[model samples]
Target: MSIPGQIAAALSLWIDSVANTVSARLERARGAQQIAISEDEEGALTLRLVSKASKDADLPPVRIGIVDGAISTPLSPEWSAAMKGAIVDLALRPSRFVFRPLELPGRAVEFLDGIIRAQIDRLTPWSPAEAVFHWTPPQPIADDHVELTVVATARAAVTSLSQALLDLGATAVDISTATPGMERIAVHHQRIGGQTGSSRLRFALIAVLAIAGVPAILSIGLGGIVTDSYDAEQQQIQRRIAERRAIARGSQGGPGGSAIELLARRKQTMPSAVMVLEELSGILPDHTYATELRIEGDKLQITGLTHDAPSLIEILERSPHFASAGFFAPTTRAANESGERFHIETRIKPQFGSGT
Candidate 1:
């Protein structure tokens, strides 16, 4: 490989190694407190420390002691005195520091009390373990002894743990509940707290948009009313247009008003047809039988039977009232009567009858 390529490969490997180490440590810490509860292997869950105390064969792997009330342990007494404020709460013993890892059982509480008494006996020769271990509530003792609560257990254990931690050169000891600490450091701290704010803002923006949508829907409903108004206006305009067109058509021309004009024209022409029929009746020779009369436009056709066709023709020709009358169907033998049947058409001119 080239020099640059080899260097890149080395750097990648180094980065991978660091990432794996950090991930493994995080997983170990997450399981730490729960390990002791489920198993007797205390060291697996123990917080690793930087030891300054010389190793001694007789010392137990872990020990316990207690303190009085709350106390402050300084990283540097000079700076602590200079600042003159509480940096953190901690407990101390000879070469050990203590911390409250989690809540302890009642047996653990008695154990802590016994350990503190032992510590007091060892450190101050004049005080007996029982005398140093004695604790009384501020109020008068209701009974000879008051029950030791978890509060006492936590205080005693945490103080002793802090002192034990001091032997290992650990300047600070932290106590945490297993569940809350896991949630706080492991779960919550792994996520971005600021993203939670962004999510909330997004939720609020969606709510605003949803609320704004109502006005748009209302506007659409209002538009429907406006549209209906527009449609009604259009219908009215159309009705007026149709009415005006009808009026103009009625006044304009041929056939003054539809069927009325036709009826009037028929009335004028029908009187003449009646007079022609009357005149025909008078002019027809005897024994001439008329059976059918039909009118086509201005022409009238008469069809009937006649005994003498020549006489009928003579009667028609002699009439000055008739313009021209001619037989269309000449006489032919009928079934009941062997008589002549004929059809005659005539034009009724104005002079055909009494100036009609």
Candidate 2:
């Protein structure tokens, strides 16, 4: 197999192992009843509820005979009902399984399962795939070595027994064997309800992920297209602006230059009102008072009452900010007025720097 395929298989096996462990813990926490089924030399089966409580010990065992892979006597209704949602521990006669002892360095203990599987064919009459097998806990021996016994039986026999118990409504089945003087060794286990539920849940999760992925992929593609479209539009607008600016620069000597250049030239030649007001405030006499002032383009107008109206024109004409200073209207005084009323207009110089 390819590396990716091998990795995927490994990951799947790990997930299955973790899920089974969690399920087993949850079942134990719920205190599921244990049922023990033992097979005799004649292939007859004995079933009894294994419980710690004293009251359960008085219940009689149910016996059933097996012939040609089928039960000859069916279980009673009460016994059948008790089988549902129970953990069935089935102990087969030792003669049905082959026992082999294996010794390995103590460091190899963690990898014992893989080592036994690889060497199963050399130790037994059947291949690993054709046999259901398990090893007892390792015992430390001399020379830093550990020894254990591998108990194995034909897969067909164990499968037949487990299927029968499942058919009788057992939630899970554990297959084991005990030698004349050795402790019981568990060979295989099956969780009927858990397997079916896990398969359904895995299918549902895959379906949900597939459904959600379609919209996510489409949204990413559509977002890229929209961004490209906006970028193209922006580029086109920038190119048009550049073309317009080039045409304006080329038409500078025509009827009128660009509007921006025209506005800039006007600003340079215009007289600022603030500068004009500042110059006038210093130029005017202390006795003179101005009531109204106006500045338009390069021209300034001042109207006020003063003790000396003629002297105002002389003062303005001498300043660098005023080019031509004169009165646009006649100077007149009213009967109740204490001073002469004068109107003066001036053509301001474009020398904004000297004023500053």
Candidate 3:
């Protein structure tokens, strides 16, 4: 079989899963079958306890077993206390610690991290890299895999919660800063096969019909306006064609520049240049004067001089109408009438002719 076929075959047996977190106590039991199972229970469930620590030496050991589900005994007292202590320690830190049902703890951890980071940035200035997160596995499964659980809290929060737990006669130990764990089971359900191709064809046909109906529905509702809009567009296109042909007729020889030149000449003949010059004159400062003005396409480059080059660049940068303006190193001249003439140049965008 091909690699993809092998993967697909494997996927067929693999069950999709979601991360789950259970904040519970572990009980030390002698026998493996310590869980209390009820006759009324219909399904299977696995229970696990995870301990988060600041250091390896401070962590407490937890044991788990299967027993009758009807017996309502807390899993592990020593481990449960340790887990509670972790929660208390997490709560005391500057980090906001939330003990949520581990149903979707992976997503919960992600959202909590963002919330804590934003809160920390607002409350105190700190770098996220300097922050450390220490986590311990629930139980080591050989050397390669271990069951781990994590609680995300800020350093400040840990300190606060630790002190509070201490007053309550609980010895809160520091563990890892950030700990995350996942408990996922590959649940198998009876695979019932169904027709796949027919469903795909039906979905495609429904999508096509839905898309085709939009233009038809719009045209029907705006029938009169649609006719007027089509007529206007046709007229505009015909007018442009006529103008292009006339320009092409004139540009028969001598290296043609029909499309761009015609447009440029039309723009140059327009009365907007005088208005733009007037606006520029009003905005120009006392000492600055335009020595040369060049207009290319819709760009206007003005070569001018100001006594202070840096101040001129600052003024241009602050202007709302101009997007970006840079000053070139000014060329200094001998003491002319204007006392050491320094030439500077700047560029600005010119309002373009409306393109159809």
Point out where model 1 deviates above 4 Å: 1-271, 352-356
Q: Against the correct fold, how does model 3 do in TM-score?
A: 0.21
The whole-model lDDT of each prediction reads: 0.41, 0.76, 0.38
Highest lDDT: give the candidate number. Answer: 2
- Tell how far residue 117 is off in model 1, in angstroms: 99
Give residue 222's lDDT in candidate 3 (0 to 100): 100
Q: TM-scores of the models, in the given order? A: 0.23, 0.51, 0.21
Worst 10 residues of 3 by lDDT: 17-26
lDDT of 3 by residue, 259-305 (tens): 66666545533335565576568677888877776655434566765
Clashing residue pairs in all predictions, respectively, total: 13, 0, 39
Write one digit per residue (lDDT tens) for candidate 1, span 1-356. Answer: 67567545554544443443344344334432111101022211221112212322122222222234322232243222221211112222211211112212222233433333334433333243122122221122232212221111223444444444334333223332222122211100111112344445445555675688679869998999999899679757855664555555556645656555444334434436677778889988777888998767556687887766556766776777555677654334333454556678775543333321
- Worst 10-residue lDDT window for candidate 2 reads 260-269
Worst 10 residues of 1 by lDDT: 184-193
Model 2 quality (TM-score): 0.51
lDDT for each residue of candidate 2 in 3-97, tens digit (9 for 90 to 100): 56754555465455556656655665677778999999989999999852344546679899977656788998778767888888899899999
Measured on C-alpha atoms, candidate 2 has an lDDT of 0.76
If both were scored by lDDT, which would come out higher, candidate 2 or candidate 3? Answer: 2
